[model samples]
Target: MSATDKKQKQAVIAGAGPAGLTGAYELLKHTDIHPVVFEESGEIGGISRTVRYHGNRMDIGGHRFFSKSQRVTDWWDEIMPLQGAPSLDDKLLHTTDKTFAANGPDPEQCDRVMLVRNRISRIFYLHKFFDYPISLKWQTFANMGLVRTIEAGCGYLWSVFFKKPETSLENFYINRFGKPLYRMFFEDYTEKVWGVHPSKLGADWGAQRVKGLSIFAILKDMLKKSFSKKENIKEVETSLIEQFVYPKLGPGQLWETVADEVRQRGGEVITETPVKEIHVENNRVTSVTVENAQGERREVPCDYLLSSLPLKDLVQSIRGIEVPDEVKRIAGDLPYRDFITVGLLMKRLTIDNQTRIKTFANRIPDTWIYIQERDVRIGRLQVFNNWSPYLVKNYENTVWIGLEYFCTEGDAFWQMDDRAFIDMAVGELAKIGIIDPADVLDSVRIKVKKAYPSYFGSYYELDRVKEFLNGIENLWCIGRNGQHRYNNMDHSMMTAMVAVDHIAAGNTDKSAVWSVNTEEEYHESK
Candidate 1:
């Protein structure tokens, strides 16, 4: 077959991120639609790539997804499988920080699940979820008699009764979590993560994420635990909380596997090939033009195309794709706060136990201690050793302590030299007594320019943009950047699957792809 014939037969994929790679893997396995993945970065994993830092392994912003789908879990096993994964029990010891003892579960690790008591043994708590699943028992118990709990209750009542019509996150959170929790637990870490006030974020995202758990739920959990009432079947947070999984190495392993499988299935995954222009013809996506590292350009075409590139980008290069200038203006207008992860490879197996911080510290989110009080750039402290011990080196045990910093794309922190960033992290860790700077074996930094999609209550405009793009034929987009959605890894990969199924079935549907972060069974537009 000629080169063009071969290219045409193979489905051309844009971006080697998880979504793109997942689509390529399933498509190749289920159909003859050989998929060729094109990634802008030289590396395979997108936001989830694993970095070997100072002889230690680390991930970005502790980006592993613990609460997720069985389908995604099964697919991961098919590719990278958790060969060296430590048992769930072993994982517990790692996550227990002093903050956990002083406060509660970190929002990052709060994948609430039922506590299966070991009748097989002496009924020692199988997993460390307080009151198991909802954690209502633990949350209320920890904050008992504290004014903050009453304030949070008032926040909820204020939200429910006053019913703030405001849609921005700042208003939503203030209404629900009260100013104390919002300022203490959310403010600085949020400002560092998103470079915006929690108040400025859209409430819709908050609604979708932490909507189910309420003061009422907490009270119920407390009563149940007190009476030792046996629930026939423990109903965990069915809305979003449940048992979750992660890659043994790190979340990055999943995307890396998909990229590997794409090539193994006779398709191609070309990394570092940035698409300069997405060529279009007669309202259909004809091909994508890419540039190699040497500043050379090449064009590849396909009858079908799946894009995980940003929507504003796709619409800008294509004609007859009626993305209104106003709409495009709004879409382009969407902004994101960049994130930098300062991964510290310390000599110890865990952080110091003397910290008075709580797991989800009111001010610092005791889970990831937010050093907001200090003028330092370190935003949140992630005890990576708590996430998984396998990422560390040596049988003696190691600690992967991370600090999350926020910045604009080209700002000081984002542009800060790697060595300097590492130094800054070690300094901050020492100041907080979380780590001994001398004990820091080494550190590394990974900067994510588009780590989060900032919601400015302009989601209506984004929705309009989606509606416009949905009208097009034979072209699809999915993923965090792909859909401009604030999605965790699981939701993003699921978007890729929906897009793939659409093209494979020769049908047209777009809703299913964006229908994630909600407990809904989505289907391709037919």
Candidate 2:
């Protein structure tokens, strides 16, 4: 066929989040395929979306833009270049260790820029702060009393000598950090986050999220830093990364920029429109039915379908396909954890700045604080000021913080009224002595469904579902919810990039897309 006579191919993408946006951008950049993206909500980013309320912005679950993949970092730089000049807080405080491009955009003057931020995350347990990975320091030992310290040491030695089979997450933790440390640090907080005991959860959860993070790794890192120059030390674990890059406004700003670029490049990005049905013919996706907010539905034809929707929803939306009964049961029973982030704009924090790190108003320098106290239901606390001064509207005067809570949808906590939920969050912070309830100025609550894909509940049998879906030659699943795995932001992008690579090369085997974060050595070496 002549070039002029050839048909123009169309690619339909569901969910305008990282994976969908990345797929559309890659298709436009590399292939001749025209792309159209549909998002259920009006917002651009999914969980990574920013919520702006009363001049203050909230980053839903605290996205730290750090990746081990060079391609991911380069992609970010291409979208929003890093700042050359210091940001507002950095300039005011004269911070010296931050990395800045020589001639990049100035964040103070430019709205579209990325800021280099310090990573300071810790654990709050027993009314004291400890290093997140259970650092070996005098203060840490002090916080954990002498008796507890000795017990932890003995338990560690015992674990080293007698390793248990890693069948459950509880066993994984006990084998790595010993039972004493795991009980003291990880047990309660993990249960709070997943609403299940560690003994019942699969070990894959630990392998993926907390890979190679253990007492031995912590000691090796400390020794390496002690001997080698800070700049010379490389290959640190992801959990031990000290610095990361973040968008000036928030993560959503980057996605919004990408969406605009897609539109400018002749690609269509329609918001408030959700892909409701998938029409398959001869084991291939040929069209998708979408519904707008006005209750209008239309079937659009496409040559390729890239889906970033939840696995359950995706399986249920398929038409003209004989899905196996086992696959249907597994997809229907796939479990997910919901999230709630309570943004509290306070005059000041009651907690003191115990660290040496300098800040705008001598506030605690923590991007995230894992709440390990069993008394309160808050899983984590995020200080927006530390994430980026631009995130908080009144950076110098007011403290913008987010309190995270994990629960299942339609539960009592999820059904609570906004005011009551905010009140409960504030009271929890007060109860934990992290804040004084009276100092709270204003509050906003945001809820996200299927925020985290759980490893339990029919998840072990997900391979059958994947095999069934892979039979559709024109369909590709790429993202956290798409794969039903707890992937980081970069992993999700990598999956989409891999799928686009396959599409461009006419390679239909979907194994590469599924193997993004599953390799043991790939995650360990990074």
Candidate 3:
């Protein structure tokens, strides 16, 4: 067909998260297809969105922009170029890093720039800091004490000789890190995050989340760092990466920028509008019914549908289709873990700055600290000032931090009022000796629904739901909740990219989209 005679195609995308926005951007860039993205919430990025309170910004869950995929990194560069000049923190500290792009925009003068940041995350157990992934250092052994260290060494050797079958997450950790280390480090934390024992969870979570991380991997990384220069260490595992890039403001800044570019390029991004019903005909999606915040609903006709909605909701939203009893039952029984981040603006923290890394006010240099204290219900803590000096309004005078808690929706923790929850969070921090409740100047609580897709419940039977969803010719599922998989930010974007590649090539098979993060060796190398 001639260019003028060709029929224009429209793609309806649900959710304006990394997956949906990526699908829309790729469609507009690669083809003549018109894309319309609908977001259920008022914000652009889902869990990746930055919440603004007063003059400070909060990254819902801390996102470290480090990816092994060149395609993903290149795409980030296209949206927000890396900083050539020093950022606020770098300029103040008079630091120089090799990751900075030459002849790019300056973060101090320009807002659309990515800053290279040091990654330092440690575990706080028994009122001390231990390297995350359990580094083999003398201080670690000292902190662990003589008896526990001996037990850990013997348990690791035993694990190396006798491997347990990978049937559950508990077994997965025991096989990799040994029983003692797993019990000491992974046991309580995993339970806190998922609200269930590791034995009840599937082993696939370990394979995907912490693929190549183990005692041996940590040892190899230590040896590599000792033998090679910092910048030349390319084979380090993802969990052990020391440096990553981040937006000047936060992760939401990047997504909001992408949303703007989509609009400038003849695409539509409607926020606070959710797809209520998806209409299918002849085994293909034909239209979707969307309802806006004003309670008005309208049908949007489309040639294809790219969905990043929760799989349970997606399966329930289908119309003019006969979902099997098994599929319906499994979808309804799917479980999710909700998250709450309490952003506390404090005058100062009680924790001392013992790390060699210098900060503006000699504060803790950790971007986030994993709380291993069994006494407190708080799971993790994020120091926003360390994430980016630009994130905090008063980086020099005050401290900005986030306390993360994982709980199921409608539970006691989730049902608490904002003020009460914030108070409880502050008290927990004080109890953990990380902060003083009196130092908290202001606080805000942000809750995210379906923040984590659980590996338990009907997750083992997810393949049956996928089989049914894949049967629909014009529907594509992408992103964490959409596929009911706990995918990282890059993996979610890659899923959308793979789906777009298939659509652009006129391929109907959806196998590649579902296989984004499935390979064990690929993740290890990446």
Per-candidate TM-score against the hidden true structure = 0.78, 0.96, 0.96
Model 2 bad stretches (over 4 Å): 93-109, 231-234, 521-526
Candidate 3's C-alpha runs over 4 A off are 1-3, 93-109, 230-234, 521-526
Please provide, for model 2 over 1-526, each residue's C-alpha lDDT reduced to its tens digit, 9 standing for 90 to 100. 8997999999999999889999999999999999999999999988888888987888989898887778888899999998888565576445432343122223346568788887889999999999887799999999999999999999999999999999999999999999999999989998998999999899998999888789888998888888976643237877887888898888999999999999999899999999999999999999999999999999999999999999999999999978888888999999999999999999999998988887755789998999999889999999998887777766656889999999999999999999999999999999988899989999999999999999997999999999999999999999999999998888888899999999999999999999999865322111
Q: Model 1 over residues 1-526: C-alpha lDDT tens digits?
A: 7755763356778888778888788788877777878888887778778776644567676553533366765665566544343354243343444543334223234222212111100000111112222234344335334675677556556666665655677666666555555654456655666666776777766666555454455566557657865542224433322223455556665566667667777888998888777666676777778888888998887777787787667667565345577777877777776788877766662232422333221211122343544355676566554444445553133456677777888887777789977887777656655567777776667777677777664556887888777776767878888888777676777888877777778778778777776553221100
Best lDDT among the predictions, by candidate number: 3
Estimate the Cα RMSD of every predicted model relative to the unseen true structure.
8.2, 3.4, 3.6
Instruction: Identify the runs in model 1 with alpha carbons over 4 angstroms from their true place.
Output: 1-8, 80-161, 220-235, 238-243, 319-323, 349-351, 354-377, 395-397, 457-459, 518-526
TM-score of 1: 0.78
lDDT of 2 at 311: 90
lDDT of 3 by residue, 30-126 (tens): 9899999999999998888889998888988899998778888899999999998856668543433324312222333656889998888999998
Error of 1 at 11 (Å): 1.8
The local lDDT score (0 to 100) that residue 464 gets in candidate 1 is 81
